[model samples]
Target: MSQTLKQPRNSTERAGFRVDLQGLRALAVLLVMCYHIWFSKVSGGVDIFLMLSAFFLTSSTARRIARGQRPPLVDGWLHRFSRLIPQAAVVIIGVVIAAWIILPSTRWLELIDQSSASLFYWQNWYLSDHQVDYYAFNTASASPLQHFWSLSVQGQIFILWPLVLAGSALIWKKFFSRHNFAWVAGSAFGAIFIGSLAFSIYITATNQQVAYFHTGARLWEFALGSLLALALPWLSSLPEKIRRFGGWAGLLTVIGSGAVLDVQGQFPGFMALVPTVAAALVIAAPAPRSWTNPSGLLSLSPLVKLGDLSYGMYLWHWPLLVFYLEVSGKQKASFLAGTVLILVSIAASWCATKFIEKPAIAWQASASFSRLIPQSGFKLIAQFAAVAVGLGVASLPVMAWENNVEHRRAMAAAQTATDNPGANATEGWDPSPTSLVLPLATELDSEWQTPGEVCEGAAAPDDERIRFCEQGGTFDGGAPDLVLLGDSHMQHWSAAASAMIEEAGGSWILVYEPGCRYGSDADRVKETCSDFQDAAQDYVADLAPEMVLTTASKTVARPDAMLRSPGEQEILVDNYEAMIQPLLDAGSRVIAMRDTPRYSYSIPECVDSNKDNFANCDGSVGYALNSVNPVEKFLDSRDYGDQVVSLDMTGLLCPEGVCKAVIGNVLTYLDDSHLSKTFVLSAKNQFASSFKEATNWE
Candidate 1:
């Protein structure tokens, strides 16, 4: 997960080769690579690497403190980063270029953001902020740079761990004798271990997706490693046979962990102890002299050499795998293909180690020819800064190109409504052909619609479950007050609704959650969805808006299958009726818009690739939607009277039974399910007419 460091010697021994540690590093990196490539599981190897990084850092710093010498904090940081940044910069640059060349344009903007985050060692924080689920099965669209999150975490700890050690050393020198430094350091790390572990457990239980990338949740692994380093001498004094048994047991436990444990879902928490403790056992036990022993096998020259290249290998493998999948259009790599990838990765890593990493490691920043270039820590840090700056400067052109593409997309989106009729093209209006698609593939990431401002005053929902509440359009006296409520499906209709409301001199409020449905009572729906439904119902009742809008059905589709089952349609209609009963009671007419068709592929990417013949990307409306609106069937079956109305816009969305990706030269769906804001804006006229008819609002 990070660059391996030379372990410090015990008090009785001189600093020398640590073959066992080298082999351990090799094994850990191998596990990480295997799990990522072949198994698609968390091997817990990165956890082991984190522990080892802290172990080496603590042992070296503690020894320096005990020897009556100040910890070389500036020199230590510069040296560590100088070694890490150059090699990482090489991989980052490679991934950037490869992504531009091989990956879909839909992924380019995200790559730019993730690449920048990775270069600056803040990738974990970026991922945590996005709430990315590391274990999600979307490998085809997965970021090649995701593996950098572990390295970023280690890079952060490399800076913080030393400062903590120095502070502890300062405390010990000020208050206690040098002999008590171990106890002082142990107490500090033990507290961190306990606190971080408790926090990790709680966060993992509550929000495992975010907890997986959160750096604070992982600090305990490093603390545990530091604790083990402080206890190494005591551990080495155990009986030789016992040490050997511990070593073998630790190795087996580590090897079997991914297979036996629910590692993807239950890791970096209490379950993480399984691998970190196993690593500690291996580190604590001395290398066995016998070839048959776990330590002896680990001490092999081939494994040691692999360990030397581990950091580079770790950096190279993931991006290579990602690019391979992208180019080949495979969900997972075949064994033969994976083998070729690994071999190429090993070769690339060797080149990086030989040409970039090893040279940087050997470069003496302090070696100066004259007085102008003084031998100082500043020079060393400057050298590291130069590498980062060079990488940043190199990325400038790519960023500029992305900006240019986005600018073009904006200009295209702002063209006359007639130029990009979108759904209105379904009305048999002939549209002129244009070379460019409105809201280009590069612009898809920003296509989701949002209200003008956060909902405030009495309009805002008091319930915490209604985390997202926003309003747009004029709220002037005598204007129609409308509320749009539900999940993202309802939210996507905001562009057309806002345009219609603004033109009519009215205001609209949007209460939305990404995945939560309005009336979902399915056992699989998160508890938050139920709470949000309750909050939305109360908010609608309190506001008593003239009309409330929500999605009345759900789309069910797969790449190979597109139709929803009859039972599924019935369930959705039932959920909708229960949801709107409250709104009807509150004198708010429910304008239930039929849900948009969901596709099994990226609409933008499909349109981008098939620009010359985008009709190839079109789907059958009958397959993407029900033969009849399920909500209307439910309405007719019962007598909800005039309060409940079904507003089916499938005619505008999928004209002549076809759901097109690009209609009237404008991109429709943002991805597979959501509508692009530009396309929705094009539908404003039709949407307004439909709204007036449904609500009987002047």
Candidate 2:
């Protein structure tokens, strides 16, 4: 048996040459497991696994159909469910129970919600929309079931792949033979592979976050593998030397891919081709001599045994890693510790596979013996119903938590009193904005909105020079002489700035974008924020006001770096030097305002969710503490910082290092980070003196 498993010498010389493709299966699964565990750079394992899945599932289904047998869709689905669900269920239940014990109350609820979503297929979309950082940042929480994203993608394929094969087989029987069907199927899949690859590459370049989650972009890799399987009979006819060469080359390609790739490498795009193609090549080749087979690499008693438990291992590993991280609060495990962890995980996976999975599958298979037996058509329908109920139940808390109107009303009243102190401190702050406030309420509304707009400020000007200097259509003649140039951060300070400028007899002009930062590069952006930075720059340089002011969120830097990278830092410095040099040379001052500290809690939801407990609402403080400060590092550069005046707001928001989101029913922030309009309006008076000193407003 061992000798029979060895690589074939020649095609004609060897009859029924066996390649141990399951050995390749062992290879594919292990590669993925290792990549997830440590390497972080290579997605070669995932690409290879995708190809293997296409090869096995598509080829097996097509063969069954071509042999004039109708596949039992329900039974086949049951088999797949039996194979996958047992392990998945064990992981989900274990993770959920563990999370309930270990996580904070708020986070525990989020885990329950997310885990339930994972049981259904929508977890991919859920994580994608949330922009869940899979690399697991130090401050952020990890999703134990995140690895299920790939499994969900595969299950999606399983759902539809057989139907395509069955449909193609029907057409072939009506018009031609089984051989013709393979060719037709191969051609169709080839087209899908090509189109999907192009789309994947395009989306990765355009919207990588979206591309990462998109199944459409990933589907082609699998199709490519399936196409190879359809052509296997023709490939098997090749000379033994060619077949043997292909098999060896395939293994080399896959292993080499794993060794070379890493986290920083681009993925699921054109880069994935190396391992995917190699997997196809390996699948096409016949088995080596059974006993002396190079297939022994996968067939090793230990490896094969691990391979049997691999499905469960994959399900359990991530959650375990997450639980460890949560409990220990450290990402890097010592080498020995990591090794021990892996061994423990492997043992647990075996138990899960042997006990939970094997028994559950066996019971499920025996129609009458299944636990949680559907008692209805196909377990999927029952699963779907259960999943729907779970999700609906999960959503209720979030909705109820967010919809607290009484909290908002009370918050509004307190803010009104703070803003209009001189207008008779009557009956605890009038609820209406129309009462007892002049420029305080209306002017504040225009600048610091209740729920900020998507994009804001002046029309694009024709001359780049005149535009970049000016803020919001050539000096609106409002209050402040100093112009605020940039995005929403500048907008947040607009009301306070206006009050200060008015008191100091100066005018304020703002050139800004709603969801943008100051000085963002145009080429870097794909959506609405693309042209925003350049447009604002033109306004600042053109207006040439006495001083330019702006602020930004620190976390915005990461996504910005990704969008327009390479020489970005240098380019930004140059642009600032060039744009502001002309202003400074022309006698205009440049002032870089320190961005306000983001609230630890989402203020709007806080009043409702935690009902006044600021400490409880705030999440892990470590990440929030590390968030960016525009003023902190603005002076690092030689060119622009020389002319920049720094204004620190840390004292205002976080006095004594503790920031409160709600101060006596006055919510400080409308959302997670940005300051609320009502809060900003009330606080403008406090900032007036500082504004006068910074801008030299006379």
Candidate 3:
């Protein structure tokens, strides 16, 4: 995670070079590579790297401060990043080029975005925002740059840690004697460790997905290293026998933690102590007493060499493995294949370290360039600036290509009504064929529907279960109010529903949770889903709007079959009736929309890959949906007396018994199951007509 492969020789010389730590670095990267390639799981290795990086950094900076020198804030950043960035930029540019050649067009824009994020050291935050599951084993679909997350976290802390130490130094200078600097610094790091650890535990329990990539949550690992560095001198004074035992024990634990623990599921929290503390032990252990000692094994020459290439190897291995999986179409690499990957990664790492990282460092240290720049700090800054500029220049072609795709998507979306007739194509409206499809594969992120603005004041629901609320049209008291309630299936219908409602002199309020359906059976739902469903029912009852929109059934698609299960359909209908009873009592009409057909594959990705023969992506409506609407059965079984209605738009979605990926040049579904905004907007007229008939609206 950290560029700790080669610490500055000056620091190592002053500190009495810890050859064992170098070997530890080699072991850590090896664990990471093995686990990622063969096991598709996280090894505690990156956490160890993070700790080691902090240890080296804090030890060097504390020494400087103790000698009354400034913390070298700007120069350190310039020097560290200048060494790190060039290698990272090379890997990022290489991944971008490889992705463009090997990955599908649907993944291109995301690859570009993640590439920029990786280069700028914000890839962790980007992945967190997207809710990427780091533990998931879908290597072919995984981002080639995903491993850069740990590096990104390290980069951010590198910038922040120096400032933290500088502030502590200033506090010591102002409020205490110079001798108390260690105490002040220790206190600062301890506070960070305590506070970040507490936050990590809390967030991990609530949402481990976000906690994994959260910078604040991972800060404690660095702080632990900082604290250990401050105590290393005292620790080294321990008996050699104890140090030897600790070294062997720590090494064993570090190697075994990933195999024995659910590291991917529980990390950066209490569980992270295993590898991090073991790494601390390794760092604190004394040098080998003899060739057979625990420290002696780590100090071997081969490990030291591998450690020298560790940083570049960490950068190279993941992308190569991801590309390998993609190119080979395998879920995982065999042992031989994985070994080849490692060897190739090591070769690439050596080339990068020798050709790029060493040259940059050499140039920065060159006497001639130093003489020209004179001031060491300015020279460092200029070196870093050159690296940044080089990376930015390398990224320009990818950015330009992304912009062109965006421009084309905009043009395609704008022409949906004219060139892409969508549902109207089923109604005998023959539109001219167009080369592009609406909601281009690159634009799938924008396929989800949204209202004009977030709901507020009277329109907003008071309940916490209303995770997201948005309103369309003026909230003037005179406008007819309608509420759209359900999971993402119901949410995707909002574009056409909101447009139709606003055009009818009404306003729409949407209350939604992505995977939580409104009327699912309580026993069958997660606690969160059950709570949200109850809250949604209460909100709808209290508002008593003219109509409530909710999905009436759930459909799932598999390779062998695509249909709603009979048992699930019956339970859903029963739950729907119970849910609507409150709305009926409040004198509100209920319009239950039949769930859209689901597909086994991503519709847009299929369309993108099979542009020549679109039929390859098409599905049978008879298989994807019920022969008769499930909601009709619910209506016939109930005696609600015209209070409940069923709205089935399956005809428009899957015209003439076929659910085509592209309907009239407008892509229908964003992925397998959700309708695209562009396609829904194109079908607004038909949707509006269906809504009016169901509600008997004027």
The segments of candidate 1 whose C-alpha lies over 4 angstroms from its true place after superposition are: 5-15, 132-140, 178-180, 365-368, 371-435, 452-467, 470-481, 506-508, 538-545, 559-572, 585-588, 635-643, 693-697
lDDT value for candidate 2? Answer: 0.57
Residue 258 CA error for candidate 3 (Å)? 1.0
Q: For candidate 1, lDDT tens digit of each residue in 1-698? A: 43463321131155444677878887888888888888877798888888999988888888888888988777788767767777788887878778777776777777788888887789998878775532122334679999889888998998899889988888888887646788988989999999999999999999897888889999999999999989888888998778777888999998888889888798788999999899888876766546656778887878877777788778888998888887788878888988888788779978987887665554554344457655674567566574666467547755775676677767776677677666656566765565467777776656788856998766767788789888887776432378888888888889888878877778889998778778777622687777888888887887888888888777755532445453244224347777788888888888877778888787888886776788989988867777767777777898877787888888777878888788888888888788988888888888889888877877
Which should have the higher lDDT, number 2 or number 3? 3
Residues 1-698, candidate 2: write the lDDT tens digits. Answer: 00101111232244442335545655665666566556533446656666667776676677777677875476566556445655566667777667656654334434555675677656767666666332111125567777777777777777777777766776777776735678877877888889999999998788776777678888898898788878888887887667666767877888778777542246778877878777666666555544333454544655555555556666676777777766785764556656666777778877866776555544443444255556444445543433344445444543443343234445545554545443123355443443322222112223344121222344335543322222322235422257766655666676667566555655556565565565544423645455656555655566566776765323322214355421122122214444455556755667766555454333444444454254664433222344444344546645553456666565556545656554433555555556656567667766765655665546
Clashing pairs in 1: none
Give the per-residue Cα lDDT of candidate 1 at 277. 94
Could you give the candidate ranking by TM-score, starting with the highest? Answer: 1, 3, 2
Q: Give the top-scoring candidate (TM-score).
A: 1
Cα RMSDs of all predictions?
Answer: 4.1, 9.9, 4.1
**Candidate 2: count of backbone clashes, pairs at least 3 residues apart or interchain:** 44
Alpha carbon lDDT of each predicted model:
0.78, 0.57, 0.82
lDDT ranking of the models: 3, 1, 2
Candidate 2: which stretches are off by over 4 Å? 1-22, 72-75, 97-117, 127-142, 178-180, 205-209, 262-264, 288-292, 369-483, 487-510, 513-534, 540-548, 551-650, 654-685, 688-698
